[model samples]
Target: MEKKMTSGKLELVAAKKFAPYGEMYKVVDFLNKTLKDKQVIFGLTKDEKGQMTLSIYET
Candidate 1:
């Protein structure tokens, strides 16, 4: 059987990827440092101010 997050809790987490600087690398670093045996979900989206941002969640 496949496991799912449906029975677990998801928490919103944030990481920085400043403009004209490190982007994906920063996220990777964050994940390498913080991630353990849990699960993660991520995506790219624009903010209200029209800034492209990355969203990461722990489940």
Candidate 2:
């Protein structure tokens, strides 16, 4: 699943990936700073083990 958020002149995208903890943390941090706005979207997914993951994209 994916969640999207947008504001005037700003947009955010979030996605989830099945990756290592280090990679996931890097992605989350990047998105947090990259977006730097309340108008952010979050995308979530689950692995076969039922582990949920999140990713974010911003513009």
Candidate 3:
């Protein structure tokens, strides 16, 4: 599972297929809408198939 935190909200994304860049793009877009020029923090863990536990914090 993926967990996310931002200035506006905090939520989770479910575990899924191995797509690094694509998943990150979704993360970035989510932050952009929520943060609007704020800072971002990421906590990440990955497995062999590139499945990940991703966390984001924005301030």
Candidate 4:
């Protein structure tokens, strides 16, 4: 996900093949706090099929 500098919201785009299973809101809330306050990026790779991505920047 990328943090839009103007709106200060996360933006994610992917194909329909990418479907993540879990409580996304909880995860996003956690990430917002961490990335916004700490300025730290996080990412995870799941083989070559998909990945979880985040940015560490504030507007």
TM-score winner, 1 or 3: 1
lDDT of each: 0.56, 0.59, 0.54, 0.43
Clashing pairs in 3: none
Worst 10 residues of 2 by lDDT: 14-23
Question: Which residues of candidate 4, in runs, are more than 4 Å off?
Answer: 1-17, 20-22, 38-58
Candidate 1, overall lDDT?
A: 0.56
Once fitted onto the true fold, the runs of candidate 2 whose alpha carbons sit more than 4 angstroms away are 2-21, 41-50, 55-59
The total of clashing pairs for model 2 equals 3
Please, what are the lDDT tens digits per residue for candidate 4 over residues 37-57? 555433333335554343333
Better of 1 and 4 by TM-score: 1
What is residue 53's positional error in candidate 4, in angstroms?
11
How far off is residue 7 in model 1, in Å? 14
Local lDDT at 13 for model 1: 70
- Summed backbone clashes in each candidate are 0, 3, 0, 0
> What would you estimate as the lDDT of candidate 2?
0.59
Q: Candidate 3: what lDDT? A: 0.54
Better of 1 and 2 by lDDT: 2
Model 3 per-residue lDDT tens digits across residues 1-59: 45443335533333344456656757756766777665544445677887765555544
* TM-score, model 1 to reference: 0.39
Clashing pairs in 2: 13-57, 14-56, 15-55
Clashing pairs in 4: none
Error of 2 at 13 (Å): 8.8
* TM per prediction: 0.39, 0.38, 0.28, 0.32
